[model samples]
Target: MNRLALLLAGSAVLAVATITPASASTASAGEVDTVTSCGNSGLQSGLSTRLCAEVTGTTVEFYGTVGLAGPPSPGGPGPAPKELITTLSTEVVGSGAAPTQQIAHVLFTSANLQVRGSAATVPCGSTVRATFGVASFPWAPRPVAHEVVITC
Candidate 1:
């Protein structure tokens, strides 16, 4: 009975460790890291335009805020905020490191809010703090977003 109990306990521990998600993993020496730099920068609004090429590290997170520009509510109409449909596309650039990209559809209706975004692209031997995507709503009238390239 003692032998059987110990065997079951060990099996359960192994299963639990293997099932844990990467995001849930504990931060350790070899686990989490970050790098920041100046990502793509420009003004975007009206019609449809996109900003790209920005890079940042996976471990690094960027944050920023965005506010409505131009004019205020004509008559303080409904209390509900306006909604803007925006798309975020991210991908790694160049060789030396693994390639990774992700896209997300975001809806912005808040007049002001902080954004957080991250990307990763770190070469084996390089030293520089750069920007990943800025943590600002890309749909804002005037948004200055940065990008992230994550590496360990």
Candidate 2:
């Protein structure tokens, strides 16, 4: 009787352990990252924003903000506050296939914004790549853009 009771208890514990639920996981709608560079002659500054992600479907969406900081003029004062230069939002589609690279749309939110050239795109994976030079400033060292690259 004692042996049978012990066996039943062990079996019950095993059953409970096996039937335990798994923890949940979270997924992002997309991912975004930024890169920035300082300006020359205190005229303009350089900034670059890059976003990449993969989705099952042909379309992907991106949203984020880009900012710039400038040092005070020579013999002036400390660095100035960071300024919000742009709020970016766009939908990109693949050229074709499981992995494709496409240049997403770009928008300038700041009234004083000045861009150099144009944005470029590169593929990183089945659903990921990078976009460069989305926006540029007149006083900045060079042109800049908020590039969005997507895969999968």
Candidate 3:
């Protein structure tokens, strides 16, 4: 009887091990995952920014510029002049499944910028990356603020 019990236990253990995938057992409940994307102006004529993030465990605090476009014609087909501005700021926070896309809009003097992207669900820490450039509107033509990337 003892020998039979030992054989059955060993076979059951082996069967369970074979049925499980390696990733499941290797990843602990405390482990975290991340998602990322790049900011770009696919929808040109104005500013388009991509907000990307890497969500760690749970509860993440992240900050980033949604979108930026540039050098608008002094007077041409573009955003209304009154919308042009020297600076812009935006914010967002929430939780859900993983890899949910988020969208935001930024208005500048000569152009309108749209930000579209995703963020990680909460309980997980979030890391953000952003890019900014000189306003597309005409000004003193200060140094062209090429692509600026900041990590938050």
Candidate 4:
């Protein structure tokens, strides 16, 4: 009886030890690591844009903000704060696959508006390859996108 019990207990322990790692690996197969990137507006002065992105297993986070990059001009931010519209987007690339993308629009009212963000975090089924964060500032002549790249 003692031998049988000992053998059964040892087998159970061995089975558990082996099973645990497999389950852990299976769970982590869909896990995503932290990926971060940042971008800056191409503006010279006055109101400027700063954008960043963080990609995780379940969500892609955007940190887009508008503030004073340099000394303000004699005039205020713009003809209209409503016109101070900004666009932030992300191309999250993982495991050599096509990038999952999301975009958000933000309006900068004043320097007090610290952070503007987007709610797009489509789960990546594999490890992250890279995260590309793009910010578009509404300039006079034409709008251009500035990109920040982050690889994991």
Indicate which candidate wins on lDDT. Answer: 4
CA displacement after TM-score superposition, residue 21 of candidate 4 (Å): 31
Candidate whose TM-score is highest: 4
Query: What ranges in model 2 sit over 4 Å off?
Result: 1-44, 54-59, 64-79, 87-152
lDDT of 4 at 147: 37
Worst 10 residues of 2 by lDDT: 35-44
Q: How high a TM-score does candidate 2 get?
A: 0.29
lDDT per residue (tens digit) for residues 1-152 in model 1: 99999999999999998899867765575643433344444434422222433333333333433344344557875334434433333323444443233333344453554444464434544332322222234444443444433434
lDDT of 4 by residue, 1-152 (tens): 99999999999999989778675656656556777666545442245555556666456566655565566556655434443434443454443545444444445445535344554545435323322232434333122233333333
Model 2, 1-152: lDDT tens digits are 99999999999999987787543233345744343322222222343333333232333333232333433357866344333343233323364534223333444433233322223343444222323233243332222233333433
lDDT for each candidate structure:
0.42, 0.37, 0.38, 0.49
Candidate 3 to truth, TM: 0.26
> Once superposed on the true structure, which residue ranges of model 1 sit more than 4 Å away at CA?
1-43, 46-58, 62-65, 71-75, 78-80, 96-101, 118-121, 124-152
RMSD of each: 11.0, 11.0, 14.5, 11.1
The sequence of per-residue lDDT tens digits that candidate 3 reaches over residues 60-126 is: 3233332335565676766554332322122232323333333333454433333323332332233
Residue 140 of model 2, lDDT score: 26
Ranking by lDDT: 4, 1, 3, 2
lDDT for 58 in candidate 4 is 59
